[model samples]
Target chain A: AQSVAQPEDQVNVAEGNPLTVKCTYSVSGNPYLFWYVQYPNRGLQFLLKYITGDNLVKGSYGFEAEFNKSQTSFHLKKPSALVSDSALYFCAVKEGGNNRKLIWGLGTSLAVNP
Target chain B: EPEVTQTPSHQVTQMGQEVILRCVPISNHLYFYWYRQILGQKVEFLVSFYNNEISEKSEIFDDQFSVERPDGSNFTLKIRSTKLEDSAMYFCASSGRTSGNTIYFGEGSWLTVV
Candidate 1:
């Protein structure tokens, strides 16, 4: 079945350090991948998406993700972490077609310490 | 920028009571969707509505669940009889005319069943 996997349950980074939240997906067709962030008590907020373009896609809040087709991965990254960036991150995927539903990954909680 | 909006940011109800969650999708969007996430769990698709009808729904969207675009502006999800397992954060989302367009989500309604 089509699915998304966020391997890390939690990631910790000191302020100003680079951070990474890993994601991998398996789908039958071209995959539309997305990243969403959720602050405590808030809903999912779109961060970035990779449809068909350059491998590097930048999103809101200085976040970027690299879509690696060969590895079946779309890992989220940030050059510098902020305490404010500490939150739950989710990776979702949808097959390219008439399917409108998204397959979600178990969220990864990131904690950026000052 | 326009964004989806949902009402009753939080609601608590006894099991077996009926609950309706209301949403106002972005004015220009053509597709609307409902999804839910139990505390500390991955997001799950509930149903999708388009052109005044339900286009898709997951197994979780059983007979107890129903969706309606009552008018031009409001989309609603009604639970015929709530259960303790129904406690979740319900998100309302919308997208442009095409399936590839990014789906923007609302702040979500937290439904607590006791």
Candidate 2:
């Protein structure tokens, strides 16, 4: 079984400030974690993924996420936020092995203000 | 860069009517999937298709739901009879090999069941 949780419904950050959107997951086996962003009236765009190896994975548009095994978390971060970065973000997990279906979080709305 | 494309960006159908949502995945991708996001809800996986057959499906993919790669370029999801609760944004995604690989999603088709 696999599940992902994004506890925050929304997160606000000032432009040019660091921002973080939290994500936690539970999987019976190793997990393939991913982050995706969705702009208004647009489809989900892949941000980055954590399959193995490095705990810190860099992704598109200067965004990155750290996989913390001890905490069972994968949090998306950006050193400097931009107003254009504001969008709905989702965390997804696919349990290792043959489970090809992705279990997604409820999503968090990020609002970067200038 | 190649991308997954979906048709009927928006569709409205009456209850009990059958509807087919279509997608054209990236040309080189092999695995295809369908997911739906109801308003204010998390994205839920429906099914995964490969080699002209369903590889895996979630509980949400019932007898009323069916998927097929009707031709070389198109993948389709058919709902036998839509209910009001069936209204949602359906996303089509594709991946090259494994669940660990990056999956690209289409812009999604909005189905409004009336």
Per-residue lDDT of B1-114 in model 2, one digit per residue for the tens? 899999999999999999999999999899999999999999999999988899999899999999989889999999999999999999999998766789999999999999
Model 2 per-residue lDDT tens digits across residues A30-85: 99999999999999999999999999999999999999999999999999999999
Q: Highest TM-score: give the candidate number.
A: 1
Residue B93 CA displacement from its true place in model 1, Å? 0.4
- Per-residue lDDT of model 1, residues A1-114, tens digit only: 899999999999999999999999999999999999999988889999999989999999999999999999999999999999999999999999899999999999999999
Say which docking band candidate 2 falls in: high
**Residue B94 lDDT in model 2?**
97
Please list all clashing residue pairs in model 2, or write none if there are none.
none
Q: Rate residue A54 of model 2 by lDDT.
A: 92
lDDT score of residue A32 within candidate 1 = 97
Give TM-scores for every candidate, taking all chains together and pairing residue i with residue i. 0.99, 0.98
Candidate-wise lDDT, in order: 0.97, 0.95
RMSD of each: 0.6, 0.8
* Tens digit per residue, CA lDDT, model 1, B12-114: 9999999999999999999999999998888999999999999999999999999999899999999999999999999999999887899999999999999
Error of 2 at B66 (Å): 0.9
